[model samples]
Target: MSKKITLFAKIFSISFLFMGCGMAVFAQNKTEDENVIRCGVGLLSQSPTIFTKKTVSNVSVTASCSDTTVYQIPVVFHIIHNGEAVGIGTNIPDSRLTSQIRILNEDYRRKEGTNGYNTDSRGADARIQFVLASKDPQGKATSGIVRANGGQSEWQLSEQAALKDKSNWPKDKYLNVWVCNLKNGAENLLGFSSFPVNSDLDGLPTGADSTTDGVMVCYKYVGNSPLSTRYNLGRTLTHEIGHFLGLIHIWGDGFDCTSTDYCNDTPAASQANYNCNTTYDSCPDAQGSDMTANYLDYTYDACMNIFTQDQVARMRTVLCGSIRRKTLWSEYVPQEEPKSVSMSLYPNPVTNSNVIVAAVTDNADVTVFNAIGQKILQKTFTPTADKITINLPEYQLAEGCYFLKVVQPSQTKTFKVIVQY
Candidate 1:
């Protein structure tokens, strides 16, 4: 009698064997002893042929400004697990998720009191903040955290799409982050992120694939907890988010020093530094030492501290230049009671010049504040015949996020404006 074959069983056996070998290699590497950041950005650039295209093609470099523009990004965390209750096993508690968000904002903004904040002159407050989305994609109120029973104890890189599909919010409006127990076989594989594939290098539409858009993080590395010794500060997500915002490895994703990360500031290096050794310089031709403290490197979480000024500019360019990312922050117009006066600013996101047009019954005071709430410019305007135009020169103000407040006799109205040089 001819032997019958079960195709499904045979395939499962082969897959299990492959997984076993992968695990063996990972275990032998002693990844925990030496810090390793298994970011999938380099892997994504290799396959599918499309991701390899240069990210900044037609995008022109904006003049670096003393003040960095502040961008508010809405974030949602998707927790995937088997049947474990909240706060058990891979089903992390809400506090842990919230703590991760806190760490991200502190690192990006360079909050004064945090250990992540650096006093070095190169240290920069990215002026970027992350907040839990108050509204869901369906327009319903939400806590910004989605929980799904994936029915799987662990997941691999190949299963990212399956895990994300379990629960995904709109990528354009909110940054979706998935937290789950990654496959133990790939012990060093901490996390990965999909680059902004919504547009091509030339700023043309590439029809970004929604399924593979956001970020995937291992549950153990998601938060700053006592159990997570080396990576307890939650810098892994910070590093992955750097990729999400168009930052490559400080070594330029190559094994040689000839490669460049496209930023003028970051020094050239042949490889990533794993530990907190600040004196290691891999490139002889470079101007400065290796930037192991940079968030884009594979340094230990406690060692990572700053993002250079050039890096801040690069990220802001992606935020405002990329078609999908540019619209992340919707214009918020504050409502007010009916008034006889009307005030407005034209050429918003003003580059070279700006004019404030106002139709008012009386004189008013206008004040401008930087993103950090420091008053930058203030002037009182007296309208002629209920209308007047005021010209704002670009030389006086630096490129960044600002707020304009107009004080009238009846009430005070404030408007948000972006200045790009």
Candidate 2:
């Protein structure tokens, strides 16, 4: 399947000033489990076919499908702290939390020039986007970030329910991410996520345990900040979210090449790679080398970069097939307030010419720009009754990525569009 690249809004610029701070140096004693074994190993003990059967079947059916639909998932960050004052201890500032969300969107969408961009041909734009929920579960206005004092200093992987119960929104409506101190026995764990458990072997409906259906991460590894150091760059959540979206470890959570992660593009490895070693391929018999750069690997945060094309298909299937996850993209659900106007552009990658159909509230201006932010076309149109169609000839645009900005009386929205011969 040819990956569909949908641009939303302008390119987000991420600052790397905090990257030079080095690994997180804490006063607590370190364990044999260094920075890489952060993700929980419990899920591996589940039905192995859970990741293989569902993912492989979905990928095969969608192999020739073009992902033109854009999925926007609402997220809620549950910040759990040890009764520390605001901006102190585990209660990280909202600025840091927001940066993490930005990283998720950029990495999943494959924004141009961002750290998420990979040169590998296997790299794909997932067409999945995340936005912080603007409304609470009760329909009250909120920033989507819930802060709570769990009364404890640290939370163990086994105590995920206790940490999540401290403050959790409806799991079906929002992607709940608990940020606090996470530990696996005596070792400090980075993060872990629960896979979408809404089906059985017979395709029967068997929902997952609601209390433990989200992601949990240590506060220090939450974002790309000075405190997060080595595991910074906000890839920890990206990796965990991959699990939330139904992606398993690239190594298939085994010590032998026989185990597979269900993706053909990723090479089999006997074990996970700890550091940024690109040349280390444990399974020589498999096609190609170990996909050390994949987000599903145990490689360092800075080294992990892309998701393979089949991985994208696997995730999209979970969103479309899961009972609860499927509701995230529902048109009936009320998204963020001050909702942007709805618009559509067809024959994307514009073969010869394209038609843009938009529901304009009033007089609006449409502007198109190339990948480098250069304006290529602009027009002012007053909708007859709330709709307008603009014809764009292929001769006017070179084959490349472009952005379409719509300026209306109430609000303005930007969409990424690709024009190709």
Candidate 3:
């Protein structure tokens, strides 16, 4: 909720601007203490404040507001680290990235029974989905994740232009997000994203679409974990993407009632609420109370769960109008969730008998690999019911960490499984 509400209704040419980036939209204040956890959002100068040569009065938003088609966005996660090993320091593992992606789908889709679900009448399924880029700009197959050594320990928010140069794909083709140590001194800033510029404009900053367009996220907050209790759920990225897609803070980035986020459904809040508390009413005089649960606010990960109809309209409109955004979905072919993406092993130490529990919808080839990269077992298993339970009884040889690989027609995925005696 750091940035003030600023969205251009038209992607016109010859207009100048930035969003005011009001949520303190470009900066996040990290807490210094170990026991206490907190974060803050701040405004930035390079931020684009205005766009649209002139408001296109005839544009219709009816199709956007009632859009039922689930638009898929191709995203490229650039892991910028100082040569840290996988799963260490700023270089996070693929599973954590997968976890973060799953959370994005859950939150954006608002699937029931998940943390992303909410009962609010204004709550909506944005219908916009995210997919890792399956192919690179040069027409090469990729995981959509680019990991590189930045040769630096940390990056400054002001240096985003240079930081992005470390490993960036074409912005008009993919949604690039740099995950690294955004540590200014000892503080850990969560993340920030540059607002989308109208490509139809001229006389703007040179290479505006390529230079200052993308997102920045700290490594610790890239994925979900109980250890990251306050910002644990990966909602940080979700909120920033809301900005990337054109949704501003619910409070309008001010205490005055006249300020607005441009969404009619969201009730105006006097200020941003950072905690999980939701009953506070910053604006009683307004129609409804504060929409603390709205993803645009700086609420805790757990407190966020909804995107209103109007908010969805704003985002979809951006996707349609912004030249840098409208074609991102075409960068990759969308596929259904991987089968057995996250396999769970029962009874920590794998003995003579081990059970694999997961939500597998179709047939898949399963293979178990030892720690040394040798295949220990290979079998074909088909699930007969919604709840899948497969038994593997060959863990007697060693007591250590192993991996399970699942191969399907569409994709191949691996999971970490522990074997014990």
Candidate 4:
């Protein structure tokens, strides 16, 4: 089993400069636990309030997954432990993990019959897939999972400690997630994503993408298990993966009531709520209760079974860009082993300035995309010790989401950026 990391006090110098500006756009909160859920949304919105409506129905929520191209995602599981086998309750069964992956495909692509969330079950089946890597950072094939014994794992702002040997996986090839026994007050915290395109691991050289840390329950309650249905539902991974792909909670942070979860389509709830029998209306001024059914909310697994079209669009944007896009359906087939190039995007979610691109080896042309899958920017970078910058000022992009791609000689890197108005 992996060692758990604490989170009640993990601090990173993130900007709160615009936190107060968008409080009025959300619905009124019903309580505190709900507020914690809502605070998760607080991180998603840029507006003061989010509007809603009863019009959003099952059809609106259903996503299309007609495209069945398998997306091959190189996965690296970091098993942090104090003194236990890497494969513990925390380590989900491979069969269960595979089921969860299938769920992601079904949900994201809206596969029929398996649309557990009751939303429209149609779209390019994200044709994407994940595999446990057989190689380590040293160029050895791995089981896509890593295990380390003993380490101080805490999410405290300043004490964001790293394990003893945290540098064995290669970020450019694998989607790294550290799984462990979450320290006190960290369970339900599940996982959090490190903004992609940034390789600086604040404390260690763990250039992985997101951190999936939590308590591992037994088979009766863990992955794909109905016993622990609510929390253990595949939804936890789906939710965290959503964050990995750049989706915020349905409600913005808890600073105020109006902030959105960053998605223009998702309603802004004053605060996020937990299981509720009564249908509470949030932001009555605008529309429906904050999308409690959204995976980003604090609802138990069974309660969350859908992702809206807008949410789908946001995720597709990541898969379509240079970051995770190429490995997505139609881009990369399972027939051939993928060849990746090293690249980076700077000033993600750029406003007036252009995003800088850096190629690790040889310089290559790059492409940029908007929310609806339209190419907005394109350029080529020459091999240079310094990065090359591409101006997207002409796109005149409004406040929304976007993706950037940079192709290099080895592995390709894609990044999802949010444009703030």
Candidate 5:
């Protein structure tokens, strides 16, 4: 089978419902661990998310945001632990947090050579990038990884606002992410996120209140933790962030075949998918098979790799239209400089011929790194042409994943490359 698993190609005309956004709690890949988040599957036995009743609007999604502008949003993580030592339990290490950010960028930007990269025509780079806040609300330098003692072992789902309030930041300025113990009695809570609301037109209630306006992810699923198993690969946050940015579950969670996610490109499915079962088609009436590979679905992290073009259009619309999210892009006066230019990589899973291609719009410095961040190859480009090609056989590197970084003055973009030969 082709690596690109595209389900349908026909354009779908969907009446985008642009009102009443709310919270979305997700239950991803089931794991054998004690702290399993039962977002309706094992323990909850109910809908993992409580979707708000959508209202009709004639707002054209594509009209709101059309430029290829990469919106970079600043994010802060509040690590709430129960007096555990740093790097233990809920008090996760810095590496784990950074890894989660890396996964987010890979998924949102569709960087090559990562699990997030996909070739399906439906798949699109959201043209969104997440930056860990280098400055705190107090204008002080911060790692964006704030560690504090929540003074509790585990929290209940009802305490969403309370926990967030304990370590709060302005939601308009920073995309707040909470990492803590949420293994409720009889079931563990994986993660949940607040949906975006377009409050510019008529006053509509966003799924989340100001107290719970960001994303809350269980400590276990925050990063590439082995204990998470099927839920690993840091996709829990990716999924929740989708909701945070105005995406609905592909299944619709409406308990019927007629349920729709408002994105025309995504086919209707009856229910959520678990693990990597991409073959199952819940909605026979729909044109495409279940989008098991979509970021909005309940499939395992490794199983999912795409967000259709319309989905991308919807999210960009939300960002540009939503009152809360519209400010997020410009709220942070960065301690870390933003990337001014971007580039793309091709033939990831590098071919046997070992020719690598990097395309940029401006003059750039191309460098290659091994699995570990070691610089193995370096070259510069003046944009005499838009494409730069390099032969990898000269380096004689082993068959594995590597990083290709392109630097253009104040901007930098990195692509992951895989070697199969």
Candidate 6:
């Protein structure tokens, strides 16, 4: 319950895999006689198609380029609600909102967090970074989350019924997400998203129709509860953000699942579902699951929680290419602590299976990459007791120099790992 829900967030969910049956398709059920998206349960039952259907652009390169700079993004949460707003007035509590933002940054940057039921074994923290937006597009100071009272409406759509006008917000400087009680048809709408309908008018993709654009959550489901409210997971915002960045659902709309959401690498599925059955191979002939772990899938919040490497590539392209998302990185100034800045690998002139990681925080996540940056060894904690031993006996990492990175929330440390195997 942070701030306003944009039309983009509301409608965008319609395009996700699980519920290809979205607002636009289900809008017929609303009293307003507006467009509504249909809601279908299982997406895995679909067929398969060629992987590379749509390209990001002619310059949309996949592998890491010569440019080593990382992209940082700023985010502003607009929490719209009808109840006595929580999170101490800034909409949802700052702690929860910050937690959500941190989760976004982590997911975008490929960090890890508490696992969900459907999370993939592969831990992919998106390489980008995110922070609360301190400045709006118009250059105004902001709390990052806004609050508006929509009266007794439970669904975000009901609140939208109160204020249907688009002038209520500043669309460009801020990505608006309205949270309210929304009922589309058979199942209550979780959230929705869309790009700018009039990109030329504002030069920013605007999301309106909060009833259909932003997230719709029941009041009881809005907090940081473990899993009580499966639909309110912040990952919903993650999925919508995927759409905002131009990635599409793995499954295509209609009965045809192979249509392609335009992103290469995501396998085609005939339909999307909320069930978190890893064995539920919808498109068995395809290379992988429709990426049900992807934040964009329709599985329950606890069931759906992972972004694939290919998905990360697509998101990175969006950040670097179209959204000017690099601007968001303008704020995060990493601390100057050298230990926080880089990690150290001991026994440089060595000849053994065990290597020591010195002077690092306890329980730090570590990754060892080859000269080309391919990760070979990844572990959660580099034990704290004595000299932390890393057994590199398997990689047959040649007698050469490699990179070792130690990471944790808010910081990353890297150093050289000279091997003699």
Cα-based lDDT at residue 187, candidate 3: 55
lDDT value for model 3: 0.68
Q: Which 10 consecutive residues of model 3 have the lowest summed lDDT?
A: 8-17
lDDT of each: 0.70, 0.72, 0.68, 0.49, 0.71, 0.51
Roughly what TM-score does model 4 have, to 2 decimal places? Answer: 0.53
Stretches > 4 Å off in candidate 6: 1-67, 83-92, 113-124, 136-141, 155-170, 185-187, 196-223, 323-333, 338-421
* Segments of candidate 3 deviating more than 4 angstroms: 1-42, 46-66, 184-186, 199-209, 331-421
Q: Which candidate, 3 or 6, would have the higher TM-score against the true structure?
A: 3
Lowest lDDT 10-residue stretch of candidate 4: 1-10
Q: With candidate 1 superimposed using the best TM-score fit, by how many Å does residue 269's alpha carbon deviate from the native? A: 0.8
For 1-421, candidate 4 gives per-residue lDDT tens digits of 0112111111110122233322212222222232212222223222222232222232122233333434566666565555544345554445665566566665555556864436533222334455556667678666665556644433321122354135334444566655544422332334444333221111111223223221121222224764353465666666766655545566544423445554546665644556633264556675656566677776666666667656665555555543432342234454665544356677876778876776556776678788899998787777567477676677787788887777766767778988875
Model 6 CA lDDT for position 44:
18
lDDT of 5 by residue, 270-315 (tens): 5566668778777776678888889888767789788888778777
lDDT of candidate 3 over 319-403, digit per residue (tens): 7767688877642245786544544446556566756645555677888888999998887778656334557664455767888
lDDT of 1 by residue, 105-177 (tens): 8898888898568887877787778888889988999999988999998887777788889998878888899
Write one digit per residue (lDDT tens) for candidate 2, span 1-421.
0112101100110011122211111111222245334577433233335323233223242332336777888889999998898789898999888999899988998887888889899999998888889999899999989999999999887788888889998888999999998876666688888777652222212455667788988888877877755688888899999988777778765435665677777777655666677887777776777888899887778997799887888787778767667776543233467665566556566656655546678787989888999888898878766776667773477778988888887767787877777
For each candidate, what TM-score against the reference? 0.66, 0.67, 0.67, 0.53, 0.67, 0.55
Clashing residue pairs in all predictions, respectively, total 0, 1, 19, 77, 2, 66
Off by over 4 Å in 4: 1-70, 86-96, 115-117, 120-128, 134-140, 151-161, 164-168, 184-188, 197-222, 225-229, 254-257, 276-278, 322-421
Please state the error at residue 66 of candidate 2 in Å: 7.5
Better of 3 and 4 by TM-score: 3
